[model samples]
Target: MKKYIAIVGSNSKKSTNRQLLEYMQHRYVNDVEIEIVEVAGLPIFKKTRDMAIPEQSKAMATKIDGADGVIIATPEYDHSIPAILSSALAWLSYGIHPLLDKPVLITGASFGSLGASRAQAQLRQILDSPEIKARVMPSSEFLLSHSLQAFNTDGLLIDAEQTKWLDSLVKDFAEFIDISAQLNHTHQEDDTRMADFSWDEGTTDKEVSK
Candidate 1:
């Protein structure tokens, strides 16, 4: 069976983002193997001289590296990605590039009508950075708006239209992984660049920002 990593991009105890991913996991149990990974409890990322990262972060990176594709379900905070999600991504990329050339599907759940649209946009930019460079599914946005009421007692999506849309997106994402693999001629180049990447030597944070 094809394996995919579903990242719960929230630290909240009752995050709708996590619920959305859980629904997908249960609904697609026969089609694909979905492993839901949590971003909670990870230490905040800080640039260090030794470049040492936490073991948990390393383990997550290894999992992602082995997966066929990735699904990130995010929740908006202050109209942007949660700090915990940002920290997790930073740890995954510092001196390591498990996401490089990996095919990714972006999903977001929000309490309000906007459905984490702004945060998803920001996350796309983050994933498109030189070190990460994940092959995000283009022109696709799965926004779970009013997510609090999106699911039912059985954890299945309540609305038929929304469920159909999500189903189609998942099918498209599976095909995207195969297509992205065919277009992976630059993988070696990206790996080489990521291996050589490092924080600006001897530069203070303030100076770098200037």
Candidate 2:
């Protein structure tokens, strides 16, 4: 079965970052299924007590685990990613790190001139940690500054050039995932062969050295 890909946005309601995610989804012509995991309903993460995690949080974790790659769309607030997004990250970290070793692409949009660049940097740091271990996209694509003017009321991207750029980013990300999977499979096969060879060599060396 083709693995699923997830697009996560910090905001639940109509958000420019969500619109950017939608634009990326439009680029998919392949068989892989893409699902959007909204982080709106999850409660703020707390480390002191065993905070009863909401069902939505658990569902998000399961979806992330099942996904082959994740696209994170977040908006900037006070020069960093929204608190809700951070909380979701915390939740994911505590249990089974769904994001560990996962390929993740992150982008953001805002009304300011910086185009949510600060938030993107902060997110990159978070995702780069050992716990997350995500392969981040290098090029900063899908950063729609003055976002209110870039997208329509129906959440469609209004700028044709921006849409094209985002499409290219998504296509590249998909190809990257495919190549990574192939490399991993090859490594596993090599490991299996090496194990078998090691067993046979050990038996032969013991008899010869005797």
Candidate that scores best on TM-score: 1
For all predicted structures, in order, the TM-scores are 0.95, 0.77
User: So what's the TM-score on candidate 2?
Assistant: 0.77
lDDT tens digits, residues 22-137, model 2? Answer: 65565463645667678887778764333356677778878877888888887889999998999888777654456665777777889887788888989999987654556676
> Model-by-model lDDT, in order?
0.92, 0.70
Q: Write the per-residue lDDT of candidate 1 for residues 13-75, one digit (tens) a residue.
A: 999999999999999999999999999999988877678899989999999999999999999
**What ranges in model 1 sit over 4 Å off?**
202-210
TM-score of 1: 0.95
Candidate 1: worst 10 consecutive residues by lDDT? 201-210
Error (Å) of candidate 1 at residue 31 is 0.6
Candidate 2 scores a C-alpha RMSD against the true structure in Å of 11.4
